[model samples]
Target: MHPLISAADLRAWLARRPETVLLDCSFDLADPSAGERAYAEAHLPGARYAHLDRDLSAPKTGRNGRHPLRDRPAYAAWMGRMGVAPGVPVIAYDRQGGMFAVRAWWVLRWMGHADVALLDGGLPAWQAEGNAVTADVPAERPAPAYPDLPPAMPRIDAAQLQPRLGEVQMLDARAPERYRGEVEPLDPVAGHIPGALNRFFKDNLQPDGRFKPAEQLKREFEALIDTERPVVHMCGSGVTACHNLLAMEVAGLGRSRLYPGSWSEWCSDPSRPVAKGAAA
Candidate 1:
Protein backbone atom coordinates (compact mmCIF):
# COMPACT_ATOMS: atom_id res chain seq x y z
CA MET A 1 0.00 0.00 0.00
CA HIS A 2 2.91 2.36 0.81
CA PRO A 3 5.97 3.13 -1.34
CA LEU A 4 2.99 3.05 -3.70
CA ILE A 5 4.92 3.36 -6.92
CA SER A 6 7.49 0.87 -8.03
CA ALA A 7 9.21 1.55 -11.34
CA ALA A 8 6.53 -0.43 -13.17
CA ASP A 9 3.70 0.69 -10.91
CA LEU A 10 4.68 4.32 -11.47
CA ARG A 11 4.32 3.91 -15.23
CA ALA A 12 0.85 2.48 -14.65
CA TRP A 13 -0.02 5.35 -12.33
CA LEU A 14 1.22 7.93 -14.87
CA ALA A 15 -1.03 6.40 -17.49
CA ARG A 16 -4.05 6.59 -15.21
CA ARG A 17 -3.65 10.06 -13.68
CA PRO A 18 -2.13 13.31 -14.89
CA GLU A 19 -2.08 14.68 -11.32
CA THR A 20 0.56 12.27 -9.97
CA VAL A 21 3.81 13.93 -8.87
CA LEU A 22 7.23 12.30 -9.27
CA LEU A 23 10.12 13.65 -7.26
CA ASP A 24 13.73 13.29 -8.37
CA CYS A 25 15.61 12.98 -5.13
CA SER A 26 18.90 12.00 -6.74
CA PHE A 27 21.70 13.29 -4.52
CA ASP A 28 25.49 13.05 -4.26
CA LEU A 29 26.76 13.56 -0.76
CA ALA A 30 30.16 14.87 -1.84
CA ASP A 31 28.77 17.50 -4.21
CA PRO A 32 25.69 18.92 -2.55
CA SER A 33 24.39 20.70 -5.68
CA ALA A 34 24.84 17.74 -8.00
CA GLY A 35 21.26 16.57 -7.40
CA GLU A 36 19.88 19.88 -8.59
CA ARG A 37 22.10 19.84 -11.70
CA ALA A 38 20.94 16.35 -12.64
CA TYR A 39 17.31 17.42 -12.24
CA ALA A 40 17.86 20.45 -14.46
CA GLU A 41 19.44 18.30 -17.16
CA ALA A 42 16.65 15.70 -17.37
CA HIS A 43 13.95 14.10 -15.26
CA LEU A 44 10.64 12.28 -15.52
CA PRO A 45 7.89 14.26 -17.21
CA GLY A 46 6.16 16.62 -14.76
CA ALA A 47 8.60 15.66 -12.01
CA ARG A 48 9.98 18.10 -9.43
CA TYR A 49 13.32 18.08 -7.64
CA ALA A 50 14.21 17.85 -3.96
CA HIS A 51 17.77 18.76 -3.02
CA LEU A 52 19.35 17.08 -0.01
CA ASP A 53 21.45 19.99 1.19
CA ARG A 54 19.39 23.07 0.35
CA ASP A 55 15.80 21.89 0.51
CA LEU A 56 15.91 18.96 2.92
CA SER A 57 18.37 20.07 5.60
CA ALA A 58 18.81 22.98 7.98
CA PRO A 59 21.83 25.31 7.92
CA LYS A 60 24.83 23.71 9.58
CA THR A 61 25.49 25.44 12.90
CA GLY A 62 28.74 23.40 13.26
CA ARG A 63 27.60 22.04 16.63
CA ASN A 64 24.01 21.37 15.68
CA GLY A 65 25.18 18.22 13.85
CA ARG A 66 25.79 17.87 10.15
CA HIS A 67 22.65 17.92 8.05
CA PRO A 68 20.48 19.06 10.90
CA LEU A 69 16.76 18.38 10.49
CA ARG A 70 15.01 21.48 9.20
CA ASP A 71 12.50 23.13 11.50
CA ARG A 72 8.91 21.94 10.99
CA PRO A 73 7.57 25.30 9.73
CA ALA A 74 10.46 25.66 7.28
CA TYR A 75 10.00 22.13 5.97
CA ALA A 76 6.22 22.55 5.62
CA ALA A 77 6.84 25.62 3.46
CA TRP A 78 9.21 23.63 1.25
CA MET A 79 6.62 20.86 0.88
CA GLY A 80 4.17 23.46 -0.36
CA ARG A 81 6.81 24.85 -2.71
CA MET A 82 7.27 21.32 -4.07
CA GLY A 83 3.49 21.15 -4.70
CA VAL A 84 2.77 18.29 -2.33
CA ALA A 85 -0.74 18.53 -0.90
CA PRO A 86 -2.08 16.42 1.94
CA GLY A 87 -4.13 14.22 -0.36
CA VAL A 88 -1.65 13.60 -3.16
CA PRO A 89 0.49 10.56 -2.61
CA VAL A 90 4.15 11.48 -3.18
CA ILE A 91 6.53 8.96 -4.74
CA ALA A 92 10.20 9.75 -4.19
CA TYR A 93 13.21 8.21 -5.96
CA ASP A 94 16.99 8.54 -6.05
CA ARG A 95 20.00 7.20 -7.98
CA GLN A 96 20.68 4.30 -5.61
CA GLY A 97 17.18 2.99 -5.48
CA GLY A 98 15.74 4.31 -2.25
CA MET A 99 19.09 5.06 -0.59
CA PHE A 100 18.66 8.83 -0.60
CA ALA A 101 14.91 8.98 -0.99
CA VAL A 102 14.34 7.12 2.27
CA ARG A 103 15.30 10.32 4.05
CA ALA A 104 12.43 12.05 2.33
CA TRP A 105 10.13 9.18 3.27
CA TRP A 106 11.18 9.38 6.92
CA VAL A 107 10.95 13.16 7.00
CA LEU A 108 7.47 13.12 5.55
CA ARG A 109 6.44 10.62 8.21
CA TRP A 110 8.02 12.82 10.86
CA MET A 111 5.90 15.65 9.50
CA GLY A 112 2.85 13.39 10.09
CA HIS A 113 2.10 12.67 6.45
CA ALA A 114 1.59 8.95 5.91
CA ASP A 115 0.90 9.20 2.19
CA VAL A 116 4.53 9.20 1.06
CA ALA A 117 6.46 6.22 -0.32
CA LEU A 118 9.84 5.58 -1.94
CA LEU A 119 10.13 4.63 -5.59
CA ASP A 120 11.51 1.11 -5.44
CA GLY A 121 14.84 0.77 -7.25
CA GLY A 122 14.67 4.48 -8.05
CA LEU A 123 15.40 6.12 -11.44
CA PRO A 124 17.63 3.33 -12.66
CA ALA A 125 14.82 0.83 -12.48
CA TRP A 126 12.40 3.26 -14.09
CA GLN A 127 14.68 3.90 -17.06
CA ALA A 128 15.35 0.18 -17.25
CA GLU A 129 11.63 -0.29 -17.76
CA GLY A 130 11.79 2.05 -20.82
CA ASN A 131 10.07 4.91 -19.05
CA ALA A 132 10.24 8.25 -20.86
CA VAL A 133 12.08 11.29 -19.54
CA THR A 134 11.72 15.00 -20.19
CA ALA A 135 13.24 18.29 -19.21
CA ASP A 136 9.82 19.90 -18.98
CA VAL A 137 8.68 20.87 -15.47
CA PRO A 138 5.04 20.54 -14.53
CA ALA A 139 2.67 23.39 -13.83
CA GLU A 140 2.51 24.22 -10.15
CA ARG A 141 -0.65 23.16 -8.37
CA PRO A 142 -2.30 24.78 -5.35
CA ALA A 143 -0.83 23.63 -2.06
CA PRO A 144 -2.80 20.89 -0.34
CA ALA A 145 -3.61 20.75 3.34
CA TYR A 146 -0.41 20.34 5.37
CA PRO A 147 -0.05 17.83 8.17
CA ASP A 148 1.13 18.65 11.70
CA LEU A 149 4.51 17.46 12.94
CA PRO A 150 4.55 14.21 14.83
CA PRO A 151 4.32 14.45 18.59
CA ALA A 152 8.05 13.76 18.85
CA MET A 153 10.67 12.95 16.31
CA PRO A 154 12.62 9.77 16.99
CA ARG A 155 15.82 11.53 18.07
CA ILE A 156 18.28 11.79 20.95
CA ASP A 157 20.91 14.40 21.69
CA ALA A 158 24.44 13.42 22.79
CA ALA A 159 23.53 14.07 26.42
CA GLN A 160 20.54 11.76 26.32
CA LEU A 161 22.64 9.17 24.46
CA GLN A 162 25.73 9.21 26.70
CA PRO A 163 23.87 7.81 29.65
CA ARG A 164 22.16 5.00 27.76
CA LEU A 165 25.38 3.59 26.27
CA GLY A 166 25.20 -0.21 26.42
CA GLU A 167 21.74 -0.21 27.95
CA VAL A 168 20.15 0.50 24.59
CA GLN A 169 20.98 -0.97 21.18
CA MET A 170 22.89 1.72 19.27
CA LEU A 171 23.40 0.74 15.64
CA ASP A 172 26.04 2.52 13.56
CA ALA A 173 24.81 2.90 10.00
CA ARG A 174 28.31 3.61 8.69
CA ALA A 175 30.61 1.58 6.50
CA PRO A 176 32.40 -1.36 8.12
CA GLU A 177 35.81 0.26 7.83
CA ARG A 178 34.64 3.50 9.43
CA TYR A 179 32.91 1.58 12.18
CA ARG A 180 36.14 -0.33 12.75
CA GLY A 181 38.41 2.77 12.50
CA GLU A 182 40.31 1.07 9.64
CA VAL A 183 39.93 4.22 7.51
CA GLU A 184 38.86 7.80 8.13
CA PRO A 185 37.86 9.82 5.07
CA LEU A 186 35.31 12.39 6.25
CA ASP A 187 35.85 12.89 9.93
CA PRO A 188 39.02 14.20 11.60
CA VAL A 189 38.76 11.17 13.83
CA ALA A 190 37.98 7.52 12.99
CA GLY A 191 36.04 4.75 14.76
CA HIS A 192 32.67 4.75 16.49
CA ILE A 193 31.04 5.16 19.86
CA PRO A 194 31.90 2.36 22.28
CA GLY A 195 29.36 -0.47 22.50
CA ALA A 196 27.75 0.39 19.18
CA LEU A 197 27.16 -2.36 16.59
CA ASN A 198 27.80 -1.96 12.86
CA ARG A 199 24.87 -2.38 10.47
CA PHE A 200 25.74 -0.46 7.32
CA PHE A 201 22.57 1.06 5.88
CA LYS A 202 23.04 -0.70 2.56
CA ASP A 203 22.43 -4.07 4.17
CA ASN A 204 18.74 -3.27 4.51
CA LEU A 205 18.16 -3.50 0.76
CA GLN A 206 18.31 -6.31 -1.77
CA PRO A 207 20.85 -6.29 -4.64
CA ASP A 208 18.04 -4.92 -6.81
CA GLY A 209 17.92 -1.90 -4.47
CA ARG A 210 14.46 -2.55 -3.14
CA PHE A 211 14.08 -3.06 0.58
CA LYS A 212 13.82 -6.62 1.84
CA PRO A 213 10.42 -7.70 3.12
CA ALA A 214 9.30 -6.81 6.64
CA GLU A 215 9.48 -10.34 7.98
CA GLN A 216 13.02 -10.85 6.70
CA LEU A 217 14.15 -7.49 8.01
CA LYS A 218 12.55 -8.15 11.38
CA ARG A 219 14.37 -11.47 11.73
CA GLU A 220 17.70 -9.86 10.80
CA PHE A 221 17.24 -6.93 13.19
CA GLU A 222 15.88 -9.10 15.97
CA ALA A 223 19.04 -11.22 15.77
CA LEU A 224 20.96 -8.04 16.66
CA ILE A 225 19.02 -7.21 19.82
CA ASP A 226 16.18 -8.16 22.09
CA THR A 227 13.84 -5.78 20.15
CA GLU A 228 12.71 -4.70 23.60
CA ARG A 229 15.52 -2.20 24.13
CA PRO A 230 15.47 1.16 22.37
CA VAL A 231 17.29 1.35 19.02
CA VAL A 232 19.42 4.34 18.01
CA HIS A 233 20.89 4.72 14.51
CA MET A 234 23.85 6.91 13.48
CA CYS A 235 25.94 7.57 10.38
CA GLY A 236 28.71 9.87 9.10
CA SER A 237 26.56 13.01 8.87
CA GLY A 238 23.16 11.91 10.11
CA VAL A 239 21.68 11.75 6.62
CA THR A 240 22.01 8.10 5.60
CA ALA A 241 21.33 7.08 9.15
CA CYS A 242 17.66 7.61 8.50
CA HIS A 243 17.90 4.73 6.04
CA ASN A 244 18.41 2.40 8.94
CA LEU A 245 15.45 3.94 10.74
CA LEU A 246 13.33 3.40 7.64
CA ALA A 247 14.55 -0.18 7.38
CA MET A 248 13.69 -0.80 11.00
CA GLU A 249 10.18 0.40 10.37
CA VAL A 250 9.90 -1.78 7.27
CA ALA A 251 11.10 -4.70 9.34
CA GLY A 252 8.24 -3.94 11.74
CA LEU A 253 10.72 -3.04 14.47
CA GLY A 254 8.60 0.06 14.93
CA ARG A 255 10.02 3.42 16.05
CA SER A 256 13.76 3.81 16.54
CA ARG A 257 15.43 7.13 17.44
CA LEU A 258 18.25 8.77 15.52
CA TYR A 259 21.47 10.38 16.72
CA PRO A 260 21.14 13.53 14.66
CA GLY A 261 24.70 14.71 15.36
CA SER A 262 25.98 11.17 14.63
CA TRP A 263 29.71 10.55 14.14
CA SER A 264 30.55 14.00 12.79
CA GLU A 265 29.12 15.79 15.78
CA TRP A 266 30.24 13.11 18.20
CA CYS A 267 33.87 13.57 17.23
CA SER A 268 33.62 17.37 17.21
CA ASP A 269 33.65 17.53 20.97
CA PRO A 270 37.01 16.54 22.45
CA SER A 271 35.41 15.24 25.64
CA ARG A 272 33.61 12.48 23.74
CA PRO A 273 35.91 9.51 23.40
CA VAL A 274 36.06 7.58 20.13
CA ALA A 275 36.62 3.86 20.10
CA LYS A 276 39.05 2.34 17.64
CA GLY A 277 38.55 -1.16 16.15
CA ALA A 278 35.51 -3.37 16.59
CA ALA A 279 33.51 -3.38 19.76
CA ALA A 280 34.25 -6.09 22.30
Candidate 2:
Protein backbone atom coordinates (compact mmCIF):
# COMPACT_ATOMS: atom_id res chain seq x y z
CA MET A 1 0.00 0.00 0.00
CA HIS A 2 1.10 3.61 -0.58
CA PRO A 3 2.57 5.65 2.29
CA LEU A 4 -0.03 8.38 1.77
CA ILE A 5 -3.85 8.39 1.77
CA SER A 6 -6.05 11.15 0.37
CA ALA A 7 -8.57 12.93 2.56
CA ALA A 8 -11.46 11.71 0.41
CA ASP A 9 -10.19 8.17 0.65
CA LEU A 10 -9.89 8.58 4.42
CA ARG A 11 -13.49 9.78 4.63
CA ALA A 12 -14.66 6.74 2.74
CA TRP A 13 -12.60 4.49 4.94
CA LEU A 14 -14.08 6.08 8.06
CA ALA A 15 -17.54 5.29 6.86
CA ARG A 16 -16.81 1.62 6.24
CA ARG A 17 -14.14 0.96 8.86
CA PRO A 18 -14.69 2.88 12.05
CA GLU A 19 -11.97 0.89 13.76
CA THR A 20 -9.26 2.48 11.64
CA VAL A 21 -6.90 4.40 13.92
CA LEU A 22 -6.43 8.09 13.08
CA LEU A 23 -3.72 10.10 14.81
CA ASP A 24 -3.42 13.87 14.93
CA CYS A 25 0.33 14.42 14.81
CA SER A 26 0.23 18.23 14.66
CA PHE A 27 3.15 20.02 16.35
CA ASP A 28 5.04 23.31 16.41
CA LEU A 29 8.73 23.33 17.21
CA ALA A 30 8.55 26.93 18.45
CA ASP A 31 5.65 26.46 20.84
CA PRO A 32 5.58 22.98 22.40
CA SER A 33 2.01 23.17 23.67
CA ALA A 34 0.46 24.78 20.61
CA GLY A 35 -0.29 21.46 18.97
CA GLU A 36 -2.28 20.11 21.88
CA ARG A 37 -4.21 23.34 22.25
CA ALA A 38 -5.12 23.34 18.57
CA TYR A 39 -6.07 19.70 18.76
CA ALA A 40 -8.34 20.41 21.69
CA GLU A 41 -10.11 23.19 19.79
CA ALA A 42 -10.72 21.06 16.68
CA HIS A 43 -9.42 17.97 14.95
CA LEU A 44 -10.56 15.20 12.64
CA PRO A 45 -13.41 13.18 14.07
CA GLY A 46 -12.13 10.30 16.19
CA ALA A 47 -8.50 11.41 15.83
CA ARG A 48 -6.29 10.86 18.85
CA TYR A 49 -3.65 13.46 19.61
CA ALA A 50 0.07 12.62 19.47
CA HIS A 51 2.48 15.28 20.67
CA LEU A 52 5.97 15.47 19.17
CA ASP A 53 7.80 16.41 22.38
CA ARG A 54 5.83 14.04 24.57
CA ASP A 55 4.69 10.98 22.64
CA LEU A 56 7.18 10.76 19.78
CA SER A 57 10.50 11.97 21.24
CA ALA A 58 12.68 10.79 24.11
CA PRO A 59 14.00 12.77 27.03
CA LYS A 60 16.96 14.77 25.78
CA THR A 61 20.45 15.22 27.20
CA GLY A 62 22.87 18.03 26.35
CA ARG A 63 24.53 15.86 23.73
CA ASN A 64 21.33 14.58 22.12
CA GLY A 65 19.24 16.46 19.59
CA ARG A 66 16.30 18.59 20.68
CA HIS A 67 13.95 15.80 19.68
CA PRO A 68 15.42 12.33 19.83
CA LEU A 69 13.75 9.10 18.90
CA ARG A 70 12.04 7.40 21.81
CA ASP A 71 13.45 4.15 23.15
CA ARG A 72 12.09 1.21 21.16
CA PRO A 73 10.47 -0.70 24.02
CA ALA A 74 8.98 2.44 25.52
CA TYR A 75 7.72 3.62 22.13
CA ALA A 76 6.19 0.21 21.52
CA ALA A 77 4.49 0.36 24.92
CA TRP A 78 3.14 3.82 24.08
CA MET A 79 1.75 2.49 20.82
CA GLY A 80 0.07 -0.31 22.74
CA ARG A 81 -1.54 2.27 25.01
CA MET A 82 -2.66 4.19 21.93
CA GLY A 83 -4.45 0.97 20.87
CA VAL A 84 -2.19 0.45 17.87
CA ALA A 85 -1.85 -3.28 17.42
CA PRO A 86 0.07 -4.94 14.65
CA GLY A 87 -1.86 -5.57 11.40
CA VAL A 88 -4.29 -2.70 12.03
CA PRO A 89 -4.25 0.17 9.55
CA VAL A 90 -3.03 3.49 11.04
CA ILE A 91 -3.12 7.00 9.60
CA ALA A 92 -1.15 9.98 10.91
CA TYR A 93 -1.66 13.66 9.99
CA ASP A 94 -0.34 17.10 10.91
CA ARG A 95 -1.26 20.68 10.06
CA GLN A 96 2.28 21.66 9.11
CA GLY A 97 2.67 20.13 5.69
CA GLY A 98 3.38 16.65 7.06
CA MET A 99 6.65 17.72 8.73
CA PHE A 100 5.54 16.05 11.96
CA ALA A 101 3.16 13.43 10.56
CA VAL A 102 5.90 11.61 8.67
CA ARG A 103 7.76 11.09 11.96
CA ALA A 104 4.78 9.10 13.21
CA TRP A 105 4.68 7.13 9.97
CA TRP A 106 8.43 6.43 10.17
CA VAL A 107 8.16 5.20 13.77
CA LEU A 108 5.32 2.82 12.93
CA ARG A 109 7.32 1.44 10.03
CA TRP A 110 10.36 1.14 12.25
CA MET A 111 8.35 -0.80 14.81
CA GLY A 112 7.56 -3.39 12.13
CA HIS A 113 4.05 -2.22 11.30
CA ALA A 114 3.33 -2.42 7.57
CA ASP A 115 -0.15 -0.92 7.30
CA VAL A 116 0.57 2.67 8.31
CA ALA A 117 0.20 5.79 6.12
CA LEU A 118 0.25 9.58 6.35
CA LEU A 119 -2.86 11.61 5.56
CA ASP A 120 -2.03 13.43 2.34
CA GLY A 121 -2.10 17.21 2.95
CA GLY A 122 -2.73 16.57 6.66
CA LEU A 123 -5.40 18.40 8.72
CA PRO A 124 -5.51 21.42 6.42
CA ALA A 125 -6.63 19.34 3.47
CA TRP A 126 -9.20 17.52 5.58
CA GLN A 127 -10.60 20.79 6.86
CA ALA A 128 -10.53 22.39 3.40
CA GLU A 129 -12.72 19.59 2.10
CA GLY A 130 -15.43 20.41 4.64
CA ASN A 131 -14.75 17.29 6.63
CA ALA A 132 -16.20 17.23 10.12
CA VAL A 133 -13.97 18.11 13.07
CA THR A 134 -14.59 17.06 16.64
CA ALA A 135 -12.95 17.74 19.98
CA ASP A 136 -14.12 14.55 21.69
CA VAL A 137 -11.13 12.47 22.78
CA PRO A 138 -11.25 8.79 21.91
CA ALA A 139 -11.39 6.30 24.76
CA GLU A 140 -8.19 4.39 25.53
CA ARG A 141 -8.01 0.66 25.00
CA PRO A 142 -6.41 -2.00 27.20
CA ALA A 143 -2.67 -2.00 26.64
CA PRO A 144 -1.44 -4.99 24.69
CA ALA A 145 2.08 -6.32 24.56
CA TYR A 146 3.88 -4.81 21.58
CA PRO A 147 6.13 -7.67 20.58
CA ASP A 148 9.86 -7.05 20.29
CA LEU A 149 10.21 -6.99 16.54
CA PRO A 150 13.41 -6.12 14.75
CA PRO A 151 13.49 -2.62 13.23
CA ALA A 152 12.14 -2.49 9.68
CA MET A 153 13.44 0.98 8.88
CA PRO A 154 17.09 1.74 8.10
CA ARG A 155 18.97 4.35 10.16
CA ILE A 156 22.59 5.49 10.52
CA ASP A 157 24.30 6.95 13.57
CA ALA A 158 26.56 10.05 13.52
CA ALA A 159 29.64 7.86 13.82
CA GLN A 160 28.61 5.71 10.85
CA LEU A 161 27.55 8.72 8.74
CA GLN A 162 30.81 10.69 8.97
CA PRO A 163 32.96 8.14 7.16
CA ARG A 164 30.39 7.31 4.42
CA LEU A 165 29.56 10.90 3.37
CA GLY A 166 31.55 10.74 0.19
CA GLU A 167 30.01 7.45 -1.01
CA VAL A 168 26.35 7.99 -0.10
CA GLN A 169 23.93 10.59 -1.43
CA MET A 170 23.50 12.76 1.66
CA LEU A 171 20.28 14.77 1.46
CA ASP A 172 19.49 17.61 3.84
CA ALA A 173 15.82 18.53 4.18
CA ARG A 174 16.27 21.87 5.91
CA ALA A 175 15.48 25.27 4.41
CA PRO A 176 18.06 26.82 2.13
CA GLU A 177 18.99 29.42 4.73
CA ARG A 178 19.68 26.79 7.32
CA TYR A 179 21.54 24.70 4.77
CA ARG A 180 23.70 27.69 3.81
CA GLY A 181 24.50 28.71 7.41
CA GLU A 182 22.78 32.06 6.87
CA VAL A 183 20.32 31.51 9.73
CA GLU A 184 19.53 28.72 12.15
CA PRO A 185 16.75 29.43 14.59
CA LEU A 186 16.65 26.00 16.14
CA ASP A 187 19.85 24.01 16.36
CA PRO A 188 23.15 25.44 17.57
CA VAL A 189 24.77 24.82 14.21
CA ALA A 190 24.16 27.21 11.35
CA GLY A 191 25.36 25.04 8.43
CA HIS A 192 24.95 21.53 7.02
CA ILE A 193 27.19 18.51 6.61
CA PRO A 194 29.81 18.79 3.91
CA GLY A 195 28.89 17.08 0.60
CA ALA A 196 25.17 17.03 1.51
CA LEU A 197 22.57 18.35 -0.97
CA ASN A 198 19.71 20.58 0.11
CA ARG A 199 16.14 19.70 -0.79
CA PHE A 200 13.85 21.54 1.59
CA PHE A 201 11.11 19.19 2.72
CA LYS A 202 8.41 21.72 1.85
CA ASP A 203 9.42 21.58 -1.81
CA ASN A 204 7.91 18.11 -1.98
CA LEU A 205 4.48 19.68 -1.60
CA GLN A 206 2.35 21.57 -4.08
CA PRO A 207 0.94 25.07 -3.53
CA ASP A 208 -2.22 23.37 -2.29
CA GLY A 209 -0.13 21.86 0.53
CA ARG A 210 -0.43 18.35 -0.91
CA PHE A 211 2.58 16.40 -2.09
CA LYS A 212 3.61 16.84 -5.68
CA PRO A 213 2.78 14.18 -8.24
CA ALA A 214 4.90 11.06 -7.96
CA GLU A 215 6.38 11.65 -11.40
CA GLN A 216 7.37 15.18 -10.45
CA LEU A 217 8.97 14.05 -7.21
CA LYS A 218 10.83 11.35 -9.12
CA ARG A 219 12.13 13.89 -11.58
CA GLU A 220 13.25 16.27 -8.88
CA PHE A 221 15.16 13.60 -6.96
CA GLU A 222 16.62 11.97 -10.06
CA ALA A 223 18.27 15.29 -10.85
CA LEU A 224 20.09 15.06 -7.51
CA ILE A 225 21.04 11.37 -7.61
CA ASP A 226 20.26 8.22 -9.55
CA THR A 227 16.99 6.56 -8.67
CA GLU A 228 18.71 3.43 -7.32
CA ARG A 229 21.60 5.15 -5.54
CA PRO A 230 21.81 4.77 -1.76
CA VAL A 231 20.67 7.99 -0.09
CA VAL A 232 20.78 9.03 3.56
CA HIS A 233 18.42 11.75 4.79
CA MET A 234 19.06 14.32 7.54
CA CYS A 235 17.45 17.48 8.93
CA GLY A 236 17.39 19.66 12.06
CA SER A 237 16.78 16.90 14.55
CA GLY A 238 15.92 13.87 12.43
CA VAL A 239 12.24 14.82 12.24
CA THR A 240 11.75 16.57 8.85
CA ALA A 241 14.29 14.19 7.38
CA CYS A 242 11.54 11.56 7.42
CA HIS A 243 9.59 13.80 5.05
CA ASN A 244 12.30 13.38 2.44
CA LEU A 245 12.38 9.64 3.09
CA LEU A 246 8.62 9.43 2.63
CA ALA A 247 8.81 11.55 -0.49
CA MET A 248 11.44 9.22 -1.90
CA GLU A 249 9.20 6.25 -1.18
CA VAL A 250 6.25 7.97 -2.85
CA ALA A 251 8.47 8.74 -5.81
CA GLY A 252 9.59 5.11 -5.96
CA LEU A 253 13.20 6.30 -5.69
CA GLY A 254 14.16 3.15 -3.75
CA ARG A 255 14.85 2.68 -0.06
CA SER A 256 16.94 5.30 1.76
CA ARG A 257 18.48 5.44 5.25
CA LEU A 258 18.09 8.20 7.85
CA TYR A 259 20.80 9.89 9.94
CA PRO A 260 18.76 10.14 13.12
CA GLY A 261 21.09 12.39 15.13
CA SER A 262 21.17 14.86 12.21
CA TRP A 263 22.70 18.37 12.36
CA SER A 264 22.00 18.88 16.05
CA GLU A 265 24.24 16.02 17.06
CA TRP A 266 26.75 16.78 14.32
CA CYS A 267 27.13 20.40 15.41
CA SER A 268 27.37 19.37 19.04
CA ASP A 269 30.74 17.85 18.19
CA PRO A 270 32.89 20.68 16.89
CA SER A 271 35.31 18.24 15.33
CA ARG A 272 32.79 17.24 12.64
CA PRO A 273 33.23 19.36 9.52
CA VAL A 274 30.44 21.81 8.63
CA ALA A 275 29.89 23.25 5.17
CA LYS A 276 28.30 26.61 4.46
CA GLY A 277 26.82 28.04 1.21
CA ALA A 278 25.31 26.00 -1.62
CA ALA A 279 26.33 22.49 -2.61
CA ALA A 280 29.84 22.39 -4.05
| Number of the top lDDT candidate | 2
TM-score of every candidate: 0.91, 0.98
Cα displacement (angstroms), candidate 2, residue 134, comes to 0.5
Q: How displaced is residue 267 in candidate 2, in Å? A: 0.5
**Candidate 2 global TM-score:** 0.98
Model 2 misplaced stretches (Cα beyond 4 Å): none
Task: Indicate the residue-level lDDT of 243 in model 2.
Answer: 98
User: Candidate 1: worst 10 consecutive residues by lDDT?
Assistant: 144-153
Summarize candidate 1's per-residue lDDT along 41-103 as a digit string, tens digits.
878888888888787788987776677788888878888777777667778888875767877
Error of 2 at 128 (Å): 2.0
**How do the residues 1-280 of candidate 2 rate in per-residue lDDT, one tens digit apiece?**
5899999999998888787788899888888999999999999988899999899989888677887888899888888878888777889999998999999999988998888999999998998888989889878873585777888799999888888878888999999999999999988879999999999999999998899999999999999876677899999999999999999999988779988889988899999999999998
The 0-to-1 C-alpha lDDT of every candidate, in the order given, reads: 0.80, 0.89
Candidate 1 regions with alpha-carbon error over 4 angstroms: 1-4, 15-18, 142-147, 151-153
